[model samples]
Target chain A: MSPFVLDDRLERDSEFVTALGLCQLRLLKDSRWPWLMLVPQRAGKTEIFELTPLDQAMLTFEANLVAGALKQVTGAKKINVGALGNIVSQLHVHVVARHEGDPNWPGPIWGFGTAVPYDNDRKHAFLTALNEAIGS
Target chain B: MSPFVLDDRLERDSEFVTALGLCQLRLLKDSRWPWLMLVPQRAGKTEIFELTPLDQAMLTFEANLVAGALKQVTGAKKINVGALGNIVSQLHVHVVARHEGDPNWPGPIWGFGTAVPYDNDRKHAFLTALNEAIGS
Candidate 1:
């Protein structure tokens, strides 16, 4: 298994919070947008294709489950799912909720604004609410 | 094999265009944002998972292949891949190249602005270039 150390980017990212479930379901600390980061428990794995077929299934299942719950909680009109490891190069999936009037409306959400760091109380509330939403 | 028909959305959106390849690749024609719409040879299917496992693999491979070429052409900082059936519900994958200064920068690409129809020449050029890049 790839050792589980948050890459400097993810670790220093005030946006990353605690994981929620047994599946290493970590919440990205990004509060500007309702985003979730899921890292399946496999070491040194950087791509979805890198996982065993069974693990791939698990990841897809969990990703879909969380994507649905996040949509319900965020009430986002659209949900964006992707794995762009260009910067982090880790096998993490991003599930972002998109709204109609978001800053980068109708555009890809990559190089938009400065990463809005999350504060402690807000982070706590968001994570707590997400956990409640998923009933985990 | 699923029968193929031009999606109505493809017809209405002047920005929609067909990909130059042995496969049925079509996209939103006028999206200056390097947005591609890949319509597989299926009738009334929306989600990528709906395809047979082999078809899914082929589509994913094709999408990634296009994404790589787009990155080279656009030098986008990030590439976003998604399949949202809210509007078309047809099994089409979106591979959009995102730059930092894009209109929808730092946000999801939905409800942003009116679709800018591509000029015939530019549209032809893009398709031609894409074909060359894909070596079709």
Candidate 2:
């Protein structure tokens, strides 16, 4: 098997937070929503079914863990989870915290608008809180 | 605990196909995409994290199974799986088969345009093929 490598698009768009059992927990840089991505640290696999059964279970567990933490930390009205590799086919799972009347309320967050990155202080504070919440 | 009831919007938009270990498999009525929904039979849960650990694992397994089956049946280039309850607020997971240059290429299929329902013969044939693929 080839060595695992993070997709270039995902690396450019997100900040790595911590490593879970089977995934690298990364926070998407877009400040518009509290979004975190779980990318399994497996190479050349573009779908969940491609993972071993154990890794698949681990991914689900870690995704749930992160989603619950994100909701509690952000107090989002809903948490959206998706794995759409249409644009960047790197097998990453997105867990986004949504509010009732946010900019793109009642719709998927992808391709809604240009992403506004978090400023320095805001990024540090958000990452700190998320790490504390996830106990990573 | 309240008895499990299918969400009104989900019922209105999908046809009941079969029941998996922890979910009710449903076929979205739209003909444009080969879409399937796995709704856990637990009542009043709007998120996967709300389900017990066992059910969460089961949901992951069933999602992978259905996604693989959908890909085989449709010969799609990619499979998108999501659990976004912004409008429906129901604990259901969507497994959609996507292809290159589809109407909503490289973007989410949600709220892109009005759904085009399948005709009677087409719907029957699709359901039959999907059922055979899933062995249900």
- Per TM-score, the best of the predicted structures is 2
Worst 10 residues of 1 chain A by lDDT: A14-23
How much TM-score does chain B earn in each model?
A: 0.83, 0.96
**Fnat, one value per model:** 0.23, 0.89
Provide the TM-score for each candidate, comma-separated: 0.59, 0.98
lDDT of 2 by residue, B73-130 (tens): 8899899999999999879899999999887888999888988989999888877888
Model 1 root-mean-square deviation: 6.1
lDDT of each: 0.65, 0.92
Q: Per-residue CA lDDT of candidate 2, range A91-113, in tens?
A: 99999999988978888999899
List pairs with backbone clashes in candidate 2: none
TM-score of model 1's chain A, to 2 decimals? 0.84
lDDT per residue as tens, model 1, B94-131: 67777777765656555576777767787677777876
